[model samples]
Target: MHLSLGFSPCPNDTFIFDAMVNNKIDTKGLTFDTQLEDVETLNRWALEGKLPITKLSFAVYLKVKEQYDLLNSGSALGRGCGPLLIAKRDIPRDEIKDLTIAIPGENTTANLLFSIAFPEAKKKKIMVFSDIENAVLNGEADAGVIIHENRFTYQLKGLVKLMDMGEFWEETTGSPIPLGGIFIRKDVPADVRAKVDTLIHESLQHAYRHYPQLSDYVKSHAQEMDEQVMRQHIDLYVNDFSLDLGTEGKAAVTSLMEAAQKLRN
Candidate 1:
């Protein structure tokens, strides 16, 4: 059977899915028609129920939980791995609300976390995740909430972090930051979902077994990212949580969802 799958072109995602989608591991008669896009695009697609399986921000998951069930594997959750609020120069926390901040996406977990942090920060401009850092530097925005690989390179670009949203979340909730996860449509057969879940686990293990060696698949989609940055991206976003959102992982995700709901209310 074939299923439509959506995920980002980020190293962490490509690293986890390389084997399963490339047939390096046994898929148990399952084949995936992959759609590689940014997490925000995937999130929008998830809202539309456009793919049978896709990776989406945990913030987006809150809105589409009724239509999708998160798969056990292929999640991006870990401590010290949350989005960063960055600016070209030092910015006072008290002044955050008054600044025009650039956000990756309105539905992104980055924006959600930022909103939770600065509920009064009403001035926000939405842009692609990859462009946020540049936007801040170019004066298009006073600051920006950056995610994915940007966390590693922002400092080098002379951008100072106004806040680490992940750190704030950890301090406030005492849980790992839930970034993104693989979600399967609830309409998929239960048995098939289980198989897909197991296949994803196997796929991640396959990638892990070949660790320290960057695969062409991962490198190809990373655009012009340096090898070190790519490795940092994978190391930060992919971990035990990616293999499965075990108890602690699930709790973190639940905390994030609950927090988002409260913010909404």
Candidate 2:
């Protein structure tokens, strides 16, 4: 069966999905008609339940939980690998409430974490993840929450780190930061979902064993990123958690959902 899959064009995602979509491994008769978008766009797609399989921010998953089931594989969850809040210059953390912030998306886990960290931050402008660094440098936004390769390049762009939201989450909850995960439509057959999960796990394992196979694919999607930066991005985001979200990872995702519910209440 053919299924529609949506994911970010970031290195980690392309690395995880390259083998499966390119037919490097057996997909159990399943073919993915894939769409690569930024994390925020994928979050918006999740809200509409548009794709049968897609990557979504863990926070966005909570809002559309009834429409999608979180798959155990292809997740970006680990320590020292969360979104960073950056500013053109160091701003007092306490003063962030009055400053307008640039977020990747309203539903992104970055924004959700920012909210949990600073509920007083009511002034926000949503921009594409890649545009946020420039937005801050150009004074379009006072601060920005950046994910993916931005964490590595922000300093070069003269951005100062205001906070590491992932570290804050770990310090508070004692669990790995739950960033994003692959989700499947709940309406798909249980067996098909299982196949997809297994296929994704296999794809990740294949990529790890043969990392060179995905290098080309990763570079093609990454913009203005050198080979080293792209490799760094993949290494940081993909790991044992990407292959399968075990006990700690699952608990982290559950915690995020529960916390989001409290925010709503």
Which predicted model would earn the best TM-score? 1
- Candidate 2 pairs with clashing backbones: none
lDDT per model vs. reference: 0.93, 0.91
- What is the per-residue lDDT of model 2 for residues 3-65, given as tens digits with 9 covering 90 to 100? 999998889999999899999899999998999988788888778889999999998876888
Candidate 1: deviation at residue 96, Å?
A: 0.5
Candidate 1 lDDT, 48-140, residue by residue in tens = 999999999999987899999999899999999999999988978999999999999989999999999999999999999999989988999
List candidate 1 stretches off by more than 4 Å. none
- Deviation from native of the Cα of residue 209 in model 1, angstroms: 0.4
Those runs of model 2 whose alpha carbons end farther than 4 Å from true positions after fitting are 212-214
Ten consecutive residues with minimal summed lDDT in candidate 1?
38-47
Candidate 2's C-alpha lDDT?
Answer: 0.91
Cα RMSDs, all models: 0.7, 1.1
